[model samples]
Target: MHSIPKHMPTSTVVSASRGRSAQEDPWWVRWTLISLSVLVLSVLVILPIANVFYHAFSNGVAAYWNNLTGDRETLHAIQLTLFVVPIAVCANVIFGVAAAWAITRFRFPGRTILTTMIDLPFAISPVVAGLMFVLLFGAKGYFGPWLQQHNIQILNAWPAIALVTTFVTLPFVARELIPVMEAIGSEEEIAAISLGANGWQMFWRVTIPNIKWGLLYGVILCNARAMGEFGAVYVVCGRVIGKTETMPIRVNTLFEGGTSETYSSSFAVASLLTMLSLVTLFIKIALEHKTQADLKEAAQTHQTE
Candidate 1:
């Protein structure tokens, strides 16, 4: 019989392996990576926002205030944004919940196709999406004659703006909820139904409570995108100054004015959008923390049970 080599001590072998595998990186390499990350962040994110605020107030506080509140065009733009964002967000919430529920809980033909189609907005360009709407609703479009015959306007109007905003933001809520719903599974819902609850009762009493954080997360993201959308809105809004201009469109119009005052005004309006984004970011972070805490608590409860 062949003699086997003696085994090394477990502690010695483990220590040798750890020494080889887990040695700390040279100090300079670590610092270089951290410095590079900070530099890129400053260049890409921090500087642009700071520049916007600087130019926004360059003409002084009075000018900034006047640009935001006193300017008729800016006010109209803000009003249009307010009107469109809510409609888009509300519509998406209903569609999102339904899509997520159908997808996560049921098996059906073309389900894969449906899920793929939900991601179409992300795959397609927003500008192209806007152009598609324009082709469908513009004067030479297929429905154009019918629309014109009825004296109904769709393109170059708020309706077109609302439609495009809804289209672009369509995926946000559904995308956010799909993974969340899948992770949660349907056990609670099945149990609720077995306990004598109806469909609506189970959804409202059980499913909604479970997915509330994820739903809120989706809504916040959807709202942010709806408010800040520029490419599609710009294409369809026709930049009709005070009439159809949203905030982003208004910024473009002001910058195109080619004057120092207009430049300041453009930055002023941009500052508002930036502030909205920052507020959304804050809410998103808080929701994430809440979600993690809830998940941990649920895990503990499950283990105990």
Candidate 2:
């Protein structure tokens, strides 16, 4: 130590230099990271939101409010949207829970194929989704004759419109629930049965509690997707103005006609959608917390018993 080497070994110098290089990220690297983050915000988020709010408020808040309140068509659209969103979401909720049960709880033949079939909508074109109904319920569709003969009136009808929208969104609830269900497994179900719980009781008490968050989150997604549905609904709906036109269809019509006022009113309507999305976001957060708390509580209760 007293006679420390006059010159530090070459290896020591190189090692110290490498450490310094690791500690100090290059300016280019930092700049690239910052640029990417800013670009993501600029393109994906900021632009669309800017466009919506800009058009919505272009005529000032007073005009927006007046349009929302006085326009019968707009008012009807909002009402119809509220009416359809819940139905579609609820349909997805029951079906999704059922699908999750079949896929996770029981082993069935063609299960993988069925799972893929369930996800088919995600891959198919929305226009195709709409066209499918057109083929099925349109004047020349496979079932069109029978349906028309029965006076079904699915084409250009709200129920028809709602069905198409529901079809497109059915996957939402299922996709959300499946993963969470896989994570949960049948342990709790088996546990419940071990304690003398019957099938109905086990599902109502154990299964529902465990997957409630998944269901809630899926509902939020389904509702949002359904409310904003355009593709399949438009094809089947005939955009029958006061009867079957959804908010998105209205925006397209207004934009095509170059009606600034109508377009702006449409955005105000879209702002209603935005409000729903925000509410969904909040609900998702709340469900996450509730699920975590429930799991922790169950764990503590289990330990004590």
Residue 99 CA displacement from its true place in model 1, Å: 0.4
- Model 1: pairs clashing at backbone N, Cα or C within 3 Å: none
Per-residue lDDT over 1-305 for candidate 1, one digit per residue giving the tens place of the 0 to 100 score: 13433575567766886788677687799999999999999999999989999999988899899888988999999999999999999999999999999998999999999999998998879999999999999999979999999999999999999999999999999998897777677878899999999999998999999889989999999999999999999999898989999999999999999998888899999999999999999999999987777567656656766
Give candidate 1's TM-score. 0.90
Q: Which stretches of candidate 1 lie over 4 Å from their true place?
A: 1-23, 294-305
Q: Evaluated with TM-score, which candidate comes out highest? A: 1
Model 2 pairs in collision: none
lDDT, candidate 2, 1-305, per-residue tens: 44546577767866887888867688999999999999999999889878877888888889889968888777777777778777777887889999999998889799999789889988888889998888888889898899978988888877777788888997988887787777677878999999999999999999998888778878888887888888887788787677677877766665665666776777888777777777878888888787676557656766776
**Residue 175 displacement (Å), model 1:** 0.6
Q: Which sections of candidate 2 miss by over 4 Å? A: 1-25, 285-305
Least accurate 10 contiguous residues by lDDT in model 2: 1-10
